[model samples]
Target: MSEIPGLRSAAGEQQGRQIPPASLARLTIYLRALNSLLAEGIERVSSDELAEAAGVNSPMLRKDLSYLGSYGTRGVGYDVQYLNSQISTALGLSQDWRVAIVGAGNLGRALAGYSGFQSRGFEVVALFDADQLIVGTEVGWLRVSPVQDLATVLGRTRANMAVLAVPAGVAQSLCDELVDAGITSILSFAPVVLQIPDHVQLRKVDMATELQILAYHAQRAQDPDLESGPRARAAQ
Candidate 1:
């Protein structure tokens, strides 16, 4: 387990920092690629091979891995298992993360049923909903708890992380409750922006925004104006 320099928590755990946001995101992709290779019993992988698996260029992948001070040998390539462990440690995947999801809607239920969360160290300990009819319903092993008991349930389940799958209108109130109950990390799917205290870390996943971006790219790809550029003009 190679330790990442200058990346440590107050408790001296391997914490992630200094890496740029884009590089950090790529590290996760690389970790996923490495895990797949490990599953296939691949002992070593060259930069080009790993890059292709991760959908990144060789030079870009090497640059991202450089943040962890991991530069493979010139010809021997990288040890797959070793590199996987290093990235896992750097991303703090070794720690147990218990998640409480607010809103027992379709999305929440789907998220709770995702087995990948457990495989990645996040345990979905609790599910919550504002509706009385939805409460007491089972999503996986978890019985949907009422949102009214949000704070109490969070404390009882010892959930340090939360997912907000509620509507934008009520997202803020639920977010405040989660923060008050000592949840410092939150992943919100609400279409509205949430304001939180400096201590809390909030990550919003706006599906609408992503869809709009995709729409933009799709439109551009089909544009006749783009086809009229140098290559098409030369063909004519």
Candidate 2:
């Protein structure tokens, strides 16, 4: 594993600086692209190629990578193995981060069954839901448990993060309960913004918002005004 400098925790009254969320997210996409390249036995890649594969602009990709210091060559591009190692270290993928999933609905079940979580640093250690009937049911290798067992499961498994896939109506209360149980890091799939303490880290994934964005772009694609700019005459 490569050494990730400045990623260590800080002492009292001194909160450590974190990588920007956008950069962190791009790092994940870069990691995935790098992994694919490695699997294909490709040892070198350019920023333009990587950006295309990762669905990002070349300049933005280069800028995001610059946050971790300059690892790419001026003209040649980046070394695949070295870049992968740097990103892995920076994202804490070199260490194991146990995760617990709250809510055992379709989305939750899908998440539990997904293998990507384990491939990265995240490990799904527990599956939790409030419904009594759903509890004790096996979803893949994990057996569902009641939400009340959150604290116990967290301590027993030493999970530092949680994912909330509950309905929008109950998501906030569930998030509060998770925070109270000492789970600091959260990934919420709910649409509503959750209220958590400063110490807690919350990342929201709003499906509705994403769908709305997609719809906006779809609508724009059908607009004659938007399309006219491509072949329009310029004013002299």
Candidate 3:
């Protein structure tokens, strides 16, 4: 790992800063870009270069990184390894996250087999399904367990995080079960609104909604009148 210069003292100031949602999202992108830079054996990165790597404007990247305290020098830019560590700590990536995937369908199996999750500190410890035939099957290194044993498997694996790749119809019930079984953080790929306890953090990824948004953007790009509209510019 490369060393970061001059900003070690500012590390303490990053705590308790309330980064806006938009900035929080961008920080993840910056982290990915920084990781790529590190893999290339690059040690230092200028704000402009880093921003371009992250696919964001320099000013926006700077603004996003402000929540974590400035670590870049006037001419030398940021230290890649140090910045990566700082971002990782900020995002709780330093801690071990055991993830259990509910519904060992195609999506669940794919997510379980993803190499990126393990590289980023998320371990897929368990996989569950309602089908008896699928339950005993192996997905990656993990054997799919029966959904009836959800709580039991979670306890055995000491899982703290969960992913719901189940259908929308059964998503809510499974989510409730996960919360009841002591899981606190959940990422749901199911396209439905779930009622979770306030203490449980839930994040929903609706692929259909994302596709619809993409369709809207495509339509706007093809239409001369829509292309010049204020709404289209705002969307961009």
Candidate 4:
């Protein structure tokens, strides 16, 4: 069987510096594109072709890749497998990162059941909630544990990252708890902002806010009478 593609942990240091988030995102996109090419039996690809696959222009792709010190051969193009591995290394996908979800409500349950996280080297080892009734219940082959067991579960599982899916009221306190438990990375789904230690890294997913932004763009498209419309320009 072919070897499974692994990723380097983003928690790693490169040149004693942290990799930028934008670079990390693009690296993942590039990795996916390269993997597709490899699966197609394509060994080499020009920057232009690869960029198109990654949904970016050639120059932009080259600039992004330059951050990793990757330069393709002058005329032969880049080796697909080599570039993919390099990007995986830069994004820290080569190592598995155990994840713990702190909420067992709807969103938490959905996240726990998602298979993509595990496929990408993130294993959801611990699932937690505050309700006594919810605790000890199974959610996708794993039993939901009480939030009170967080510290022990974190230590026993050595979980370095966590997901905060609890209510907005409880998010911050639980976030603090996660930081205290030695979890350095977190993905927060709460509608409100969470305060954590300066050393902790956080990413928030606000579906409502995102949908509002999308709605604005969609409204503008439907009504060219907005600022972007020629009619609006004449009125101004």
* Best candidate (score: TM-score): 3
In candidate 1, residue 150 scores what lDDT?
91
* Tens-place lDDT digits, model 1, residues 43-120: 889999999998888999999888876446665788887788778877778788899999999999999999889877
Candidate 2 worst ten-residue window by lDDT: 7-16
Superposition error at 7 for model 4 (Å):
18
Ranking by lDDT: 3, 1, 2, 4
**TM-score between candidate 2 and the true structure:** 0.84
Better of 3 and 4 by lDDT: 3
Tell me the spans in candidate 4 whose CA falls farther than 4 Å from its real position.
1-19, 226-236
Return whichever of 1 and 3 wins on lDDT: 3
| lDDT of candidate model 4 versus the reference | 0.82
Give the TM-score comparing model 1 with the true structure, all chains together: 0.87
lDDT of 4 by residue, 101-214 (tens): 999999999999998787667899999999999999999978998899999989998888899998899899999999988999999999998887789999999999988977
How many pairs of residues collide in each model? 0, 0, 0, 7
Measured against the true structure, the TM-scores of the candidates, in listed sequence, are 0.87, 0.84, 0.92, 0.84
C-alpha positional error of residue 87 in candidate 1 after TM-score superposition, expressed in Å? 0.3
